[model samples]
Target: MPRGEKSAYTDKQKRQAEHIEESEREQGRSKEDAERIAWATVNKQDGGGKKSGSGRAKPH
Candidate 1:
């Protein structure tokens, strides 16, 4: 995918990024910077959408 393209991310990842971005913005980051940081964080945590299937199973 092209740079800045988020199509490879899962819905949950996208939501996580959105939350991160919002928090960054609240901390005074610019919109672009916040989004960049958020996506970067998600990538760091989840490894950039490479694996198939949901990651570690949650307990019931």
Candidate 2:
């Protein structure tokens, strides 16, 4: 994947990032910085979109 591309992320992950970004922005972060932090948080929580062979599992 290219830098900054988010095609591997799930819908819920995207939503989480959006919420995080908004929260960061409200706390005075720049848009770019907030987005970066948000994505990092989602990655930290979801392990970067890794999947099991069986099927989609429940979110923690």
Candidate 3:
């Protein structure tokens, strides 16, 4: 559960991040910035990694 570790992310999420990163790079973002934006985007969409069993549900 280390910061910046992507092991908890699912394959689809990883692919989405990669695609987003590439798109960001195409739009003239730096490597680090693109990666940051990509992961942030994924986090916004998915609310973080889906592989973990705990904290996967939202309280009603």
Candidates in order, TM-scores: namely 0.80, 0.82, 0.84
User: Which candidate, 2 or 3, has the higher TM-score?
Assistant: 3
Per-residue lDDT over 32-56 for candidate 2, one digit per residue giving the tens place of the 0 to 100 score: 9999999999998888964657877
On TM-score, the leading prediction is 3
TM-score of 2: 0.82
TM-score of 1: 0.80
Which run of 10 residues does model 1 get worst, by summed lDDT?
50-59
| TM-score for candidate 3, residues paired by index | 0.84
For candidate 1, write residues 1-60 as lDDT tens digits: 788788888899999999999999999999999999999999989878746656866345
RMSD of 3: 2.7
- Give the C-alpha lDDT of model 2: 0.90
Residue 45 of model 3, lDDT score: 87
In order of lDDT, best first, we have 3, 2, 1
Cα RMSD, model 1: 4.6
